[model samples]
Target: MVKHGISLVEAARRLGVSQSTLYIALQKGQIPTFRRDGRTVVSSGALRDYQTGKRPPCAYRL
Candidate 1:
């Protein structure tokens, strides 16, 4: 079955950013996340929105 969400690490890789950078974004709420099986994951659609500049601009630069 295809996964609907991706791990933070995988998300970082797909975004071409470091995990620390992704964590920073998470902290700032720039990226949305959800708990799945006690682990944090981001939905594919959300990631796509972020990549497409659909998310609001972050106050802190990444």
Candidate 2:
């Protein structure tokens, strides 16, 4: 997972969203992420999964 990890900012940029928005998605379990060096990071595969619709938004349904 280390090799596939990227900083949250970079991931946000790649996804064309703000860091805070991405962070919220991470916190909501809408995105796959893990802590690295005490900071949250996202995997390239996770990003791909998101783009491919393998991951879904976690907004409240009720």
Candidate 3:
């Protein structure tokens, strides 16, 4: 069967960011994610939106 989403590591690689940075973004709600087959994954569309600025990054609060 084909996968609907990509692994977190792949997502980080595509975004050219470290896994820790991606994790922080996930925690801050900057990036959305879901669990599939017991593993966390991110949708390609969402990643594209983020890259294109369609999904603006969340503001950091002090």
Predict model 2's lDDT versus the native: 0.80
Clashing pairs in 1: none
Write candidate 2's Cα lDDT for 1-62 as tens digits.
Answer: 13558888899999999988887777777777877778778888898898787886676432
Per TM-score, the best of the predicted structures is: 1
Residue ranges of candidate 3 with Cα displaced over 4 Å: 1-3, 56-62
What is residue 55's positional error in candidate 3, in angstroms?
A: 2.6
Alpha carbon lDDT of each predicted model: 0.85, 0.80, 0.83
lDDT of 3 by residue, 1-62 (tens): 66589999999999999999888877777778878899989999888887887765667632
Which ranking of candidates, highest lDDT first?
1, 3, 2
Best by lDDT: 1
Model 1: lDDT of residue 61 = 64
What TM-score would each prediction reach against the true structure? Answer: 0.79, 0.73, 0.78
Q: How badly does each model clash, as a count of residue pairs? A: 0, 0, 0
